[model samples]
Target: MKNVLNDPVVNVKGIGEKLEQGLNSLGIYTVEDLLFYFPARYDVYEIKPLSELIHDDKVTIEGKVSSEPSLTFYGKRKSRLSFNLQVEHVTVKAVMFNRAFAKKQLQVGDMVTLTGKWDQHRLQITVSNYQKGRAKSDAKIQPIYALKSDVSNIQIKKAVTTALSQYQDDLQEILPEEYLSAYKLPGRLEAVKHMHFPDNHQVLKHARRRFTYEEFLLFQLKMQLLRKRKRESTFGNSQDYQAKDVEKFVEALPFQLTAAQSRSLNEVMTDMRSPYRMNRLLQGDVGSGKTAVAAIALYATITAGKQGALMVPTEILAEQHFQSLQELFADKASVVLLTGSVKGKRRKQVLQEIADKQADIIIGTHALIQEEVVFQDLGLVIVDEQHRFGVEQRRVLRDKGLHPDVLFMTATPIPRTLAITAFGDMDVSVIDEMPSGRKQVETYWVKENMLDRVLQFIQKEVDNGHQAYVVCPLIEESDKLDIQNAVELYQQLQEIYAPKTAVGLMHGRLPADEKEEVMRKFAANDIQVLVSTTVVEVGVNVPNASVMVIYDAERFGLSQLHQLRGRVGRGDAQSYCILVADPKGEVGKERMKIMTETTNGFELSEEDLKLRGPGDFFGKKQSGMPEFRVADMVHDYRALETARTDAQQILASGALDENPVFQKLAQYVYNDKIVKGETLD
Candidate 1:
């Protein structure tokens, strides 16, 4: 009701300057921030009677101190307190380590609670904590907060204890009273108190339910509002295209669309044909035909009397798509290529074609977003490898046209948790199934001892007129590394394959022109063996490259290894992905085993998310998911869905725009403070 919820952390007792700095490092600046900083996990000790207590079970029991507490000093800084407690006409021996301070507090008749494990064999309860009353200490449900190096548990608990009381009246309910009643949720203050220190498991569950809902609701509101704003932004039917043209274009393709591709295309075409502008993402494995689907969408845009723009991450990819599309469309649609290479007169000619409504589909790299590029009635925008480009870069290209329907295409299939959060603003379409008659890449995990055999195998493949890629993780010789480098591998492979096989070298450190040239040579089969790094992992289609040998494969994530594997299995020829590494750890061994077992990108991406954790999977700064206090992206998925549904209901009810409390909460969401750090985008 008041602005007092923004009380500074210094207002809390015991939070001095140094301590405040420590808390600040953990992103706690306000009293509210400290209040909402939920525990990483909870230590639950079920409070039970002596009868229900089992052997070696961590539990809490309420009883009387029937025997005087005996304190015995042990080794340095250690003491053991032994006592007997009377519970339901039964006396059980209790021993606690390093709790000599409680010796003075316990009398012969004092009622107390001890929480720990009951060792029935020895007839003793190994107590971890003792309290004056029932369910008071060692918390039947205790919270374990994540801490920084400088902060201590006592310091945070003390400050949080003070803030919990001082701001008790200030936590006005943001959710409407009716919904809270319907959900049987506790008051805001009660929930926060129970979250930090719960009396029992049932109360903690209810508290967690409340916070999880609130956290997800704020994020889903942001997502819903973004879509609503786009729909209301007035890009009308000009973005729409008839399905008949798209059908004819698809019918003309050399190969038929897979069922998954057809499903994805139908979803995209439905969005395109709507009065509202389309905003969708088509994500699939590397060779799942996302390009062909995009091509059909582009052709639809052209036939609808509007232009299409296909933006890629690299110049080489742009050139490849330009050539492929030019051949695919033939004389039906005028296609143009614009990149940094197209300079002076050539750039001017392409720009004029785009401006005069002559270029039906324009393909280029980041150069397409330059201020000089403009389009006449640009209706559809297809971005390849969309993650490689910045949000602003995509926006720049879209701005050149009056509200173009955008389709972002990525070869890397996103895990569902990431898809729901990172790309929440746009609708998603996934092509999960590969085309029929496609060759499944034969994958193998081999150790370093088998290097010679792998090399000989690559040479044998090259001798059969097929190209092979030898990928190293590093660029050059580093101080004391044991793994292969691109340059050394390039040289050694060249020396080994000699005279009979031509080898090319490519890595991230190579100049753009040099890498592109090497890639071109490999694609043309001029180079039978390409000793390169993961730079070749960026959707390079050299169908003739039938073998992919990943050096130090254990060093890469499952998703990256799968992407590397996808590069080789694109053609009709039988392909092989050899993971060359001697994995020393269980995780490394597991990664290699998984890579050898499955070629599904989605499955591998999920495994990657679990193995690497979400932070390393998507760099902390780049993860688009909002920072949540209590809701977990991985485990609290059902809560997230409920919140999303509730958010839509709230939006449809006009509560966000009309209700006073919701309006204030909406401002918090707009300022990115509701969930703290991550941007909703």
Candidate 2:
């Protein structure tokens, strides 16, 4: 049985090479994998007499076949097997379409059990499934699994049944018996069996809860272990907190720091001073002073005789940060920008200064992590728009220094549940409070036909000496159509307000220098109307830009639309975000309505998570969220919290190292973390 569990799925009785390949598409490779392939849902049917069946009531009825089943044609291509089923004094018509074979299987006076929906209007049972026996007294809950096109639920259920019958006893229990009893959870074997074929809803619920807890527990344990490994490692460089320097920097700022900003800065300061490296996530809403908070941390790093590198996702943002930091530092610390556009002697000079520690603050895009660009005494690394970069890229920058204090900044406000699960390894500080004088961007959901009105409104705003942005969705990978869309929109806007206002165009297809130039024009108000794609979703800050017209807003996620809207409302001017979308579905309309109703990013994020699920909420490509087999971050938040607490308790009890079962489980989780490049040691 143990060997059978470990064998390839093709070794199962009915699963041949072709069927095994089909199962493999669903991530089933071995017998053990097949055994754990949980069902997406269940079809529960109760055994009932024909007389008790009503319209749309799914049930199983056992009776004698009073009439011989006959195959008959209805339409040009439709055929069905018809017969009369009798239960005492009640007789019901039974119909099975496209089932000529059933005619040969069943005869008059034969006993049969038919499972289907009862249509009272027709006084018939539309047979979905059948068997040659009396219906069981107990209700049958059949597991319905998600499968590939060629693989049916019946095929998977049969395979699982065979595998379970042979090797259910060999399934190892990862959770200790003590904890199982303490949690009042069933054993692994019993849970697996009941999960696939439960006797009742109660058993099914218990099985689901047990497995959900296991999934969440394993993830939480992995994160905790990773955190523990990092804490124990002595490779980090300890830095002086430099409270005086931080205070001096804050005093130099033009505006006052909000309470949330100050608290977040204090958190960063404390983390930097610790012996262990600072791995923190700084989450703040759009227009929040996260940049200012990061600037303070960088100031402290420079004051402590260390170089600070701020990595943004775009060249325009890097330049913006460079200019802002340069002015803020004002000859106190030498700050330089190193982007792909900075070339020849200029690039070499910047690189030399950075490497020689002459440049106290260096701001750049992905160019900062290149082989040639080196940092001297790099103590602090601030990653703006952290989700844009991959884990390896972030790691490479962190490795530039010996245990650099990494502070990741995201303008996208994450729900608490997501923050805990997705970024469990890092310490998090949220600047939930926006700085004073920041105005909430007024949002409106407009139909596509209202484009002219929106454009006119934008023109009026531009005429009032305020800038505006027109954002379009990326339609194609080649970007031929997307670029053309932006270009066409730019021309259209130019023609509409041509002699009165200047317009610029930007897209992913443009060169780095051109993109920077366009953004520069927009910032300087040289371009009153800038037509672009999601490229302006982050870091193109212009206080004068008071209006944002998002074309095809239905194509964007709520968080993304929020981020684009964030590009505006930086100034005290009453900003407007006009969403011009003709959504085709309820979800999309609901997203638009939510945006129109509120300007709170956190609230919008919660709604987004519920509406779009986690995959689309954070963007599946770069969200870096763990793929859970059973645990859902949104719906199963309670389970996640419980699992987290239990994991901590288990770790504190030293059971992970003392018990062989827990040790194996920890090892498995650790190995999985390694695969994701999340291991600390």
Candidate 3:
């Protein structure tokens, strides 16, 4: 069998070095990557001819040009070309924009085909893309790949075809033959070919299913193998904690623990007591008191004479955590903040304290993972917003002073099946309950026309000595969009309410010191209306802020809108969240509906998942998420259940444990870190 990874891009017959560089820019360095690059979408030009085409119908027509193409230039900047096509007795004009080259390609009595909507109201065929000849099949589906400006689908398809032709017969069947036969699926070679050039929709469906399942199954196997390897690794001594210390820490708390929090804490405590090491994830939503629970774990490690590290995402968040931890541990536990911005003698002293174990709890951003920041005896590591931190960073923190019991926390609620699929090997504890006194932020969706009234409401609130947050969707007006910008709005609002109210603008592009200064002013009620971006999504805790107005809310995802809503309603006063929407299209209307229907972050997250899949859930380029082509997280949830059950059965039966095929599968999963003759971790 030919190894696809070893086949070079240039080794494919027709590709040259210059073209290879362009392909490499798209991350297609080898034949395997090329084959794995699935099509983003398929355009099926499966419609009747223009003669049979109805008004307002999307049709594909095959005809010959009946007239010479003519171009009309409105000066040197703008121009349009027109041509008439004769399909039987009917003649329809085809228009081209700025394509004078296309005008030359069309001659009288030349064959041409166009696929687009026949808009009778405009009396035009709004062509998306034109072809030189009619499609071979009257009804045909053409594959379209995700391409950049430098590349196109035709070039990708040709390159892929060449690569496949060289290795189609020799590609390995990764799955066992018995299972492959049972499922009635084709071999890897056939599947890859069909994915690129399928004869029919049914064939394409099967090919996609096989490829997506393979991707997902390999991901699951990799995670399983990593878990096994990590669990089997050696660990240093684990410190035992005093029950009285934990009790004292809890008793001194300002509020009582929710039942969910208490349960999650107990789970952490048990994990800390384990001999090997602990790697647990504490999943919770906003205002679920996860930080307080983490404090308990930190306290336990301290009581055992070991230090813990709390790594957050941003400097703003790290500082907030540092202050809160200092207040909680006052004179009881030593805590210090470490970040990149910390300077001179203060940074040296903090580093010294952490190195000497004088500081029991060290809070910081990525600075905590630095080599110089050695631990005297690092026992536990608690990572907040675990997804925000890269895998290498987490591994570095894990490698610091033996295998510390790692606890990851995130406010974003991941669905249970996805959690199991993503973090299947790790133990998960979810705090589904919200803490008491967290008032539901009253949310309302308003049209663009109603924005003036919303501004009036904000003015009234600011007049009452309460602070307000006005978030713009963009930093500047985008040439392609009509969304409001923070800079423009800041100027307008300043003109409207300048002398009476102070207005400030904050965005991610701002300098760190400037952002901190603006936030400080807003927190202190100095800036009556803080005009900003989504930068204040999770960091601050302002008690008196009573209003949040989000402009162009339809442009944001449901979870994001909810996060902005969370900015308000932190205090005792009645808080309000106003979402400004254009209400022009279905997407805008749906976005507004999602904001008004519910206040629960979990529900919003589910809706967001339904709207947009896990394609970019973690970020733009994500790893380890099982991309099931058939199993939709929204509609095909039943398929996910089936897959989960199938995995369980395979694990439970001695077949996977004893069979040679299964053994080979497991070894492939952990090839880099394979241990000698082990059935289980």
Candidate 4:
């Protein structure tokens, strides 16, 4: 069994070099991988009489070929094999597309089983799969695996069968033996075999339940351990702030805090004052006043005679937060910005203030996480756009203090399912509603043919003494994706609005200082129009930029489109977001409709998560989310809760340390290295 697990997938028959590469693409490396690579779904074939078949019903029917199969070559690599099959003494027309090889297997009197959609009106069957002779008993339930262009599902099924047959008897069980018996789960090898080749629906369901519980248990064990450790490990100072003091400060604010903001702020304060270290996620939409709640928490932390740090994704955002805090706490706390750009003697002074506990509130970029920047008595840490920073980066900043209360803030409203799985160890607080009297951005979907009109509208907005932003999907043209790129669109817009009003260009490829310079120019309205990519998606407040035109908007997800739209409507003046694209598919059209209909970021995020499946999930940087192969955080949430309870009980029972099987499991969990609330704020 050990050798089988270590041996390469090529040990299985028919998995040649090319198929090996395909399996590698799917992250399948060894024969053991083949055994564990379960099917995405199964097509259960129930043989039915032809007379009882309904319209478009997919089923298997036993029949004899009454006529010789005639093959016809159609347009461009297309072929159709048509034959008359006598099923239950009735002749039915059966046609198979692209499976020209079926013609060679069919004879006048040969019996076969065909599974396909039966078109009642056409009195014909569209066969998807067929067996030359009577269908094998085990073939009633066929495993269908996700495939790449290089390999087919049939090929993968055969390989999995070979590996399972070779190592079924010797497969090792990872879950504790008591768990198997208590949960009424099959043995590890039996479960794996059932997952790969389910004999019946009941067995398949049991197999799936076993794996789902297995994954959720592992994930929840890690989360529960983190939670347990946090509760037990108390801070020496044990963050303290008077409730009345926080409430009085809130009352003294110049502007009224939104109800949502107020509620989230209270939640943060409660967590901060708790005996255990606070690990929490603060979620709000773009322009939802998350900064206010964060500022209030920072106030409470500082008032408690401890330092507070606010870290953001970009230097501009850090500067913005720094300015806000500086203004809000003008006569209250000493605020300082310690970005990478703050250099020489000034940087030294900032470091001195931080070390000497003079800077009550220090805001900066990733520079705050540097080894030299030490917090005198850091009690509360607020990380804005938490998804931007990595796990180790956040850990470094938190480690600077003696188990400080960490509050993660994000303008991007993460889908609830993602939030649960991604930050299972942390408590979540959401600011769903925007502040009252905030102007909503009026979104419009403009087709490709209406480009001139959209450009004219932007030109009109610019003429009316307002700046505009044009965002593209790509920075440059690519051979693979033929879309409107930032540089090309910039050049075109520059040519159109040039010599009169300046049109500046910016993208991710630009240097940090150069990008900052362009942004500053655009923010100051020195540049009437700024053409850029989604680099401007994050918090780069430009209230003066009233018009946002997104090219190829359909190429982006709903959440992204909403974020970009948020750039406008920050000021009081009416704002507009014009999406310029033509989507051919219904999903893309629905996305466009959602955008044009509403400006709620959270609603759009849920829709976006549903639309983009596990393939794209959220985005490229979302690797921090739990990568469960079988368990779904969305659909299997109840199972996840059960697993969490079971994990907590097991931990409390000391099984991880006392039981031999659990000892091995503990080692495996440690190797998995599931960190606490790193991303998905």
Candidate 5:
């Protein structure tokens, strides 16, 4: 029988029923998962004595309790346990919150080590988990595991220790030994063990470097495979068409296309006309002519006796795209809108038309991917805000056509290093320049006390027949915050500006129809002041909306703030984005400074990445992206570069198809579970 340490969590001793349930809540169903649970930080408990510690010093101290412990309870709910410790003749107070057990364990003259900052007001040692040890003269770091509410760091550390002792020999190195040595990466098992419990700061850094590179390499390998698959598949109806019709469509537009837009359209058209299908990304800042470029592609398809589909992130965006496409392609082709809201006969008929090739241009949200929806000859598939959809959704849409040429679009500018690392397979085309006559929106930062003046500015803009968007950071009340809720803010704004203008509220919590209704009213100018959350960040396109008031602007990422600002300045009218910051600290002020300094989405995105690091998930504020604990995208750009270079070199060598090692690495990255089934074939 396998030892308890080598078996799964279910087989662990003393974790039979109740404890197993507690462990399950912490996502530790398997012993392997528990082993992979890494630390978030470490409280180094090795420091000099209190006498050696100076004023305003942050250090760890080891000493023995010299005085009787004191227990004090204030305000019924608040209780503090304190004791005096003698560290080289300098007495320091050890404090803990609601820790009654500490009073018994830490007797007078008992040895204890305390770690924290020391100040004039009571040698404050916030007692970081007392342990009996001599103070280390050398600097040391300890592992601090990220724990679920129910699971403590000690529990995870103990499990990790057990797993490391048992499974140290079982972990086979998946990467080639030569590659590992060349890159100076740790052994797979060694890295995993150190990641969970590092002995020193250098070991932790090295372990992190190894793990991050592994992640990037694995991700790149999978993307390369997918790219190969896409290229091999014969998709996209390469229908023949005249450039004259595309020119006519461009001519009919009220505004001329920017040079960047024209260049991107040319590249897309060249791809569309090619025998191989196009899978390109149309990335641009807000107010750039990407939409117009997309129109050109759709019209080119229609002229060539093929169909085109535009999948947007939200229903409001879908409706807006449908309306704009219809107006632009009224004389040339038939355009249809299909969303979940379209019911009964209308939905069925639209689906039929899509499948039958009667609809030349189809615009909708995720409803376009319904199994019933088909394209007669889907020549092109444009996914606006492409990151909003998962990889599977992109595949599903690709499967809909022979291999519809995909044009993924995003307004959120990403850093160049991340773009190359994250989007290695897909060909990228950037529309970096905005159209002429688009006056850059003037940005300002104001404190909460100056909100009234900002409101007055918004009212002035509204009075000029332009609309305004008021963005709130919170949708509802939370126990941790005293910030204003969106609903409350909407009501307050309605009361304040009621007689002069109509107020509309839109948020993710509202039913789709209600949100759409509010958005439609605002877009139509029936509601002059639209109060909303970040729900309006990507969904709506109202050129008439000229002013944006972002409440608690400091709460947002710089990239997100740029996106919110993009909501305005859509029309020719001059626009303004007022960032109202909390007066708490320089954090808010610094964020506002970044916003006021630039309007470049790419620059702002780099700054955002520099500030908050990498996010696991993104799209609408409603979507929750998974957070990666150890990986830092901005700081770890070197790792990304290393992985990309190695992947490219390997691919360039053309060994993946023939070499056994690459076959194993491919399977390792793709299946992730295939490692167990490995056998000498």
Candidate 6:
């Protein structure tokens, strides 16, 4: 019967071909998938009398029908059924729009239970679901599932109930008995049963806790195993770090290195010289000199007779890095850039140089991972804005060499808890200090009514020989979203600041060449103002751009807002970031206030995680993180810590080899990694 869990959803009792197709649309193909598809919310049907119902409150009420249901027609196509109900000494009106079936079951003096929201202005209860008569027992909590097209919550509930009844006895416990005792968790079968149909809120909470812990434990176990494999693997290149050479490189720089930058570089240097392969994450705020630290590491690798590769998210960033590296390594190493746009003779020449070991330092976008882009004795791989690349993409580049030391860098600072949970297997280095002469960008929150004032400030900043960026949430006008868009705003700004200031437009919809051109013009100060979307959030660096005005700023996450604000304040002049939005909700207002209060990326990241959870903080795809079924990086942080420790203990004790359940869990994680194109031996 254990095999029943893997049976297709079509084998379920109530799910037919049509229903199975709908379920497939929701990513539920197997019985196990159906069982794990937990309810998004529960509708508690606590019976209440009519007199206890409040205006605009959703409640379930039991009452006796006081009048016959009457059907009312608003127009030819619209009609509603209305009736009166009496509960104890109170009378209330009940209405069901387009529910003709409800009219037939209801009659005068018949007792019924209905669930809906009460409207005080209309003095009516708009019923969504109703029972023909009061139940013999108390009302039970109902599960409201997330659905796809043509699939109803009722259908999902029925299918899930059938699956639970048939497979409950066969459900195997994945957690070890000792772990269950230590954590005081319920068995797998009981947790799944209770999660779908809990007898009480306490049971539901226990079930949720068990599943969340399981997810975190499995993830931690996988991460620990990966770390073990990397440490024991003998394929990595071990390079020597010459302190004098690194010092010479640093001293020759145009500006002094910040303390934080020095510390991060030292960490990287130490990792490079270590026997074990280095898998490190370098995090810093925007403009925190992460590039300079990475440059030093690349220099060290090249100087050691090993080639290095740096992968960026966009071509514009790749070109920028290429130019910067060329200037930085003017007399030192051969530098080359390879992008999709570099074609024919140029592309072939670059590839030949790389394959021939002539190009010591290589920088490019996704084109770096193509088959033709081979490396000669590649020893170091630095992934800029690491979150932009998937785990498999990173693996592909690393596989180009015999286990090259990998360094992942990101400007989006993650919360400490998330960093531990998400990247627990990798070493972390943070550049928390800004370089000297860099001033914090002054930020302000303004309503839409202050648009003119914001525009005036942008104009004034441009007049002062500084550039400005006007960011919108959308590229084109969206009928569904009323936020300001780049296309329309570009036109408006051109008309408003035109003749006086040069305005440029950029968005993701633009072609690669066009985007590069616009950014080039903006950087060269040919365009005084650039109206664009969040594409500039990552790696478009213009030191002279001092003013950033983000329209519909409330639509962005705090971390994102911080990144956008980072585009400015890169030069010697004082900068300003104006958030033009009238956030109506408390959360949005709070997000706006946080942006105005601080420039610390880590603090803002923590707040963003708390406010929006890990999913919203960064898309799972963008972050290259696995989507957890039950565990949340923010809320289940305690569970994550315990799981990490227990996973380590289990692996260290060699108990995982003897446990079939642990083996199965490992297999599942491995399969997921394989699906994502991650390398596993």
Listing every candidate in turn, what is its Cα RMSD in Å to the true structure after a full C-alpha superposition?
7.0, 5.4, 5.5, 5.8, 5.5, 4.1
User: How accurate locally, in lDDT, is each candidate?
Assistant: 0.82, 0.83, 0.78, 0.83, 0.77, 0.85
| Tens digit per residue, CA lDDT, model 1, 303-347 | 788998898877777888999999999998999999888888888
TM-score between model 4 and native? 0.80
TM-score of each: 0.81, 0.85, 0.79, 0.80, 0.80, 0.85
- Summarize candidate 2's per-residue lDDT along 470-576 as a digit string, tens digits: 98876243434333266667777788887988888888898877888888888888888888998888657798999998988888889999999999888878999
Q: Higher-TM-score candidate among 1 and 2?
A: 2
Once fitted onto the true fold, the runs of candidate 1 whose alpha carbons sit more than 4 angstroms away are 13-22, 40-151, 176-187, 199-206, 240-242, 386-389, 398-401, 477-482, 658-681
Instruction: State residue 143's C-alpha deviation in candidate 6, in Å.
Output: 2.8
Ranking by TM-score: 6, 2, 1, 5, 4, 3
lDDT computed for candidate 5? 0.77
In terms of lDDT, the poorest run of 10 residues in model 2 is 475-484
Clashes of 5: 3
Poorly placed runs, candidate 2 (over 4 Å): 1-7, 10-22, 46-97, 100-139, 149-151, 386-391, 394-401, 474-488, 621-623, 659-664, 670-681
How well is each residue in 372-417 modelled by candidate 3, as lDDT tens digits? 8988888888988644445677667666635678888977777665
Model 5 Cα lDDT, one tens digit per residue, 483-581: 777999988998899888898888889988898888878878999998888888877889999999998887888988999999999888999999888
Looking at model 3, how many pairs of residues clash?
Answer: 0
